[model samples]
Target chain A: MFVRNILSAIIISVAPVSSVLAAGGDTPPIPSQDWSFSGPFGTYDKAALQRGYKIYREVCASCHSMKRVRFRNLEALGYNEDQIKAIAAEYSVEDGPNEDGDMFERAALPSDAFISPFPNDNAAKAANGGAFPPDLSLMTKARANGSNYVHALMTGYKDKLPHGVELSDGQYWNTYFTGNKIAMAPPLMDESISYEDGTIETLDQYAKDISHFLTWAADPYMEERKRTGFKVILFLLIFAGVMYGVKRRIWSNIH
Target chain B: MSNAPREKFDNTVVEWVDSRLPIFTMMKNEYGVFPTPRNFNWFWNFGAIAMFMLITMIATGIVLAMHYTADTKLAFDSVERIMRDVNGGWLIRYIHMNGASFFFIAVYIHIFRGMYYGSYKAPRELLWILGVIIFLLMMATAFIGYVLPWGQMSLWGATVITNLFSAIPFVGESIVTLLWGGFSIDNPTLTRFFALHYLLPFVIVGVVLLHIWALHVTGSNNPLGLEPKSKKDTLPFHPYYTSKDFFGIIVFIIFYAIFIFYMPDALGHPDNYIPANPLVTPPHIVPEWYFLPFYAILRAVTFNMNIYMLAGLGLLAVFMVEFIWRHKPKYLNGFLGFLLLVLGSGLAVFGLLADLNQGWEIPMSAANLAPISAKFGGVLAMFGSIGLLVILPWLDNHPIRSARFRPLFRIFMIIFTISVFILGYAGSQAADKVYFMEFNNTMLAQIFTGFYFMFFLIILPLLSRFEKGRELPKSINEAVLSKAQKAGA
Candidate 1:
């Protein structure tokens, strides 16, 4: 009886595999960049991070917010405490009531997060034609091939659309965007943000810098993580060797 | 080295504890002086490694939970805060995240090792079942824990899996509603999942304790699959196995540490880092890596049988056979048979091909008969794949317990492992999509899924009858001595 039941169950379980294949429109492939933080030994390029922060502050900060990151986290990007404080003070942030139970606006402290341009999602959407710009704090970790995708999308805006493809009023053509149309217009242009280090202020440079910065924002502990990882691995290897010797010595008496 | 009775405690403190609880005797008997087969191989170490991973997960998980917020609106941000704001929270979160993948990896190796040695046979059957129950609990725990992050994959995975319960006959919709705690996967679902996630690991710990007790009762099964007859065949577990387990653990830890620190997100889906959005779904939804093989089995079933297409293909096959036989008369019988075989297979293939051009829906009642609806069949197949493991003891009629002594069974075991990996690869692909060979991934998955079941249900039982077994050693001592003699010679 059990055998019969299993046999019937197997038969019932085995069935046809059929479904309409919903093929997505072709997206331009994201070209990989020479990231200073790609491999196990890779560390963030400090200068690139600073430039990226400039681009983010001058351009991207108008719409997108890095809500999870505080001004203090910029210390990882080679910024001094005074520089971070100055940067934080450049933006106005909402503060608590002063015995009047009324919320007041004040210059942001070094501890405060990079505040959103709009107060909430509904307001953000209203300002950006009903499309809320996603928070950039975890942006580098959120999408598949995130870092490259961000870089590509930033620089992928073409002057002409592909043959037979039409863009709606608000939608802009970006080669890297899914369906080749994105709500976000090309935000970066040549000479968008000048670097204090006298680096070239090309659109490509801005895109690369911002992608690097976002990656750092997403995982500020990458350099520390990799360094600690290497040390731990080294210690484990040495410990394992010692353990192996001990095991051999213990087993010799038995064998 | 001797099997003589243990010496009595000389110290009054030891005697006092022994008299009160006999905890010393229990430890000395169960662990210190426990008899284990001397010929047990490295594969045997996986159980200990799995235990280590479990403890690692629990310890790290406790720390993570201390910082994690279970609220829907705050869950994503709280996790980020854990990664950024909390002191060494990054280390704890990474360990817990990668620890899950490592835990599954260790447990899988342990389960496969059990299968390879036929540790589920006879006296050990209950032990294997308890292990399976633990596996079920682990899956539940992992799934719920995944939802606590409240990411894209978390929300959708919860939605997809909870919806599977809705495939029930009359109560399907209500079951989904109950599972959701409201109309859809919302705050309540996240809270309950967090609650259950926190609770199930303790339950697993309880089951694991029972699993260990069962293992101790039967003793450890060795690679040779021969029972230890005398004291010569067995050794005390403390110095020998303990040192060996310690070495194995260090090796396992090196690999675990590499993943935890170096490539922490390698095993995870990047989409999961995005906060959960009900308005949008990712292009492809897939479960974690360990669940992929079973996920593939779940997706293999399709409801549209295409009976008309099958009939048409059959008629075409008949015409082709007649045409071939008419064109060549000398090899008429062989050609006709070969043509018929080809045509029959073609007809079956036709039945399996989903009509991508048409929007045709078969009534649920009709679809549930021979070829079940894709949703219902997927749920059953997913569950049935795991169910197969529970009855594996009954499925194998072999007198021998280990594949080392059964050459034919060994080949089938290899094929079974390969098929499972193939199913895993297929499961990782976007389901319902056509890939290489113009055949959908589900169709590809179905072939492997068939092989997976066939190994247990058909090949194992039937092969056991006809396959000749190798000469058995009288005891483990004899097997070891013979091997040593061969080495010396």
Candidate 2:
């Protein structure tokens, strides 16, 4: 009954709003996929997030950076401490000045932020022909309809330019991007990154996995939050119900 | 017994303090036996709920300030650190983030309750005015608090809003600079906003104390807009209303928890998650959801001043001069009327000169013709929206409180509510976004803005003069017992 009531409420609030609040009139509608962590009671699928991390490391990491995510945070994806340490050691990060008073690099610790491909935004922009690679730590959050939008951009590339459309050097056409123009080339394809768990290795699978992964990355506390929310709301509901009874009892003689 | 001077407590500690300070006596007099109208509905819950949100915000904000770094370079990263590293910091920050929206929600419902019940009339006027003051303070607090995160929207929104100060004519640029603490919105601006954001809520609390004092003075205006007459018409403040308010607050928290836990960023703009970068502004910079209606008003007035506006103002000069001189309908005639007529004609002259100034390019930059005047006009309209609420008690003195008895007013109230909601929706869309033929969001906002002002300025006065209200109940007792009987209780 609790779940049923919550389901009705979620439907009441979400159904009409999603249909009506579609913004940016010129942009194409981003088709939403079933996300593991979509609702109030939903929790992230850890294995999917781990698979997404693989796709990110193999394909997108060369350009984008996850500046806010720490190596230790990957534990949320079911990594043990040793495994997290091993993952941390795989990438090096900038450290402090030593006896020589010069900044140096060392093997990364679990506490360190994700390593960046480019040292600075200026260098990244110069390398990419004046197009700076944005940080992806908040990418799924920093845009409206972020998860669907990113997924569409991943698989949205047009093989041939649509009628009279032309690209200027690096500019690529993506079906879902605002104005249909994007700076980066198509980043994923069939077998973009193979999964050992026997997950399908198609472009669609790759996009969905990464989208799931990025969603987890953006809000790592989803599982804990929803779990806590269930208990909190349940308690409040009971408390309110009992309080109403008490109020009735107190006011029984008022009339 | 309800109005008795004192009741001895069992504990000597209380008796000693009571003898010295009489605070215990004060509490008992003010709250313990205070007679509140027993006919309160769901709407009465909002006032206490609004107070609950205020305390919640303050509690969360104080904790957030502890972990926050005020510098421009560190502010965004510090917030991330709070989210990632500090234990339960995400919960605190998200509560504070979504708390502002919820705070506005409660307060808006509270204000609308006042409007629907005509709670602003007579002895409750100061109570309503205090509420409007608290509301203004809340807006300032929320706007400055938005800048504390130092995100793209924060920076750009700060820049745009502070630039509004430049519309002050001679001291405009200086005021903007003073607000920014520099030529641009940078570190100094961020730091100062943090300081002011922290300060404004306490100011709101002070005004809220005054608000509560005023409410206690005249007592709560119920849904029926009737004051409690005697014991039968009222309930004591102990287990009865306290129990009800607690239930209301907990239910409110349930919704707040849903936002904080599941969709924390739903009410917020995605651009805000991006750190502040002044050089590249977001393509569309919208204020937080609560500010949308006023933002729509501001944007709607972006058209050039023309002959039509001049003629409209020239016609409405009488309304302006009349609004300035008289507070009530009776005061609208005689010496005040004759004096206002002369002043009204003078304002028409000023309106003609203003029309002439549009073409001639006046020395006052804000008053200058063309685009700036329109922008300035937008700014005026936006402020006037709230400003009108401050004087609403005088504007509508339709003897009968509550729209339940006044059929015409009930219709006007519904229309006014609908228009505000429409204005809110129009504001949420892109200014140039057109859903139909020839009419864009800006034009939609414009028509509704006119409707919004007209409801207050023209409709209320007209209703006061002509509309005969239905019979009021003999008292709150008569209404409640009848309501119970109709329900077959």
B-chain TM-scores per prediction: 0.86, 0.90
Cα displacement (angstroms), candidate 1, residue A195, comes to: 1.7
Give lDDT for model 2: 0.83
TM-score of each: 0.88, 0.90
The best candidate by lDDT is 2
lDDT of 2 by residue, B418-448 (tens): 9999999987877667668977776899899
Point out where model 1 deviates above 4 Å: A1-24, B1-7, B304-372
How well does candidate 1 score on lDDT at residue B206? 99
For candidate 1, list the clashing residue pairs, or say none: none
> Candidate 2 on A65-101: residue-level lDDT in tens?
8989999999899999999999999998777798999
lDDT of each: 0.82, 0.83
Which stretches in model 2 have alpha-carbon errors above 4 Å? A1-25, A100-102, B1-6, B304-372
How accurate locally is residue B90 in candidate 1, as Cα lDDT from 0 to 100?
A: 96
